[model samples]
Target: SQTIHQWPATLVQPVGSPLSLECTVEGTSNPNLYWYRQAAGRGLQLLFYSVGIGQISSEVPQNLSASRPQDRQFILSSKKLLLSDSGFYLCAWTGGAGAYGYTFGSGTRLTVV
Candidate 1:
């Protein structure tokens, strides 16, 4: 069984704070990992994704960065946060595109104050 884990189910951070969110896949290897943000009632926006260790791709120009330090570990970080960064952050994984789709984490609700 494969599972994705994300932390701090909820967060309240001040503007300009540093942010770090981690996602890890257990029981899977070299899975495609993604970081997505969803505005209130809006569709998910792809922020970053990784296909392998040390490989990351950004889907949009933003204030966030993603890194894959290990085959099944992905990290999303920002040196400084923005008020617009508030949203629902979700970590997801898939063995392959158009396959089983995505297995998402419980998600983190971030509120920038």
Candidate 2:
């Protein structure tokens, strides 16, 4: 069975600070990884996606970035967080094409103060 894990369930940080969030998957290989951000009471917006190692695609140019260092490890980072950066960050995985649905990890809610 495939499972995903994300750390720091919630975070509070001052504006303009650095941000780093991690996600990892188990029981799967070469899965498509994605980072999505959901604003308060809004739908998710794709931030980045990785089809394979060192292969990242950015959906939006914002105060965020993503990287895939290992087959099952994905990371989201920001050099300087903005007030608008505060939201629910989610990491998801899909079994490439023909995948039915997404498997989302426990999300991290960030509050920029």
Candidate 3:
């Protein structure tokens, strides 16, 4: 019974401000974690992934970064948020590539004003 948690459900921030989003998992270990961003009317885009602690892979080059400090803790951070950064952010996990579909947490919708 693995589960993921993310918050705050919605966010509004001015452009050029900093951003920090957190995700955590329970009931699983060594699971692959992923960070995805879905823009308005766009498909899910991978932002970062981690196979283990301190090992992260970046899929997109944007104004954001990701970190995995613990076994089930992943964080997304941005120094200066951009207008284009406003979107739905999702945190997901899976056993592996050939495993079952991903389990996504309750996403965070960010609006950069």
- Candidate 1: the clashing residue pairs are none
Model 1 lDDT per residue over 1-113, tens place: 88889987999999999998888889988899999999998999999988889999999999999999999888988899999999999999998773889999999999999
The numbered model that scores best in lDDT is 3
Q: How high is the lDDT of residue 69 in model 3?
A: 94
Which lDDT tens digits does candidate 2 get at residues 1-113? 99999988999999899999999999999999999999999999999999899889999888888889999999999999999999999999999693568999999999999
* TM-score (all chains, Cα) for each model: 0.96, 0.97, 0.97
Per-residue lDDT tens digits for candidate 3, residues 1-113, read: 88999988999999999999999999999989999999999999999999999999999788999999999999999999999999999999998673798999999999999
Worst 10 residues of 3 by lDDT: 93-102
lDDT of each: 0.92, 0.93, 0.95
Alpha-carbon lDDT of model 3: 0.95
Worst 10 residues of 2 by lDDT: 93-102
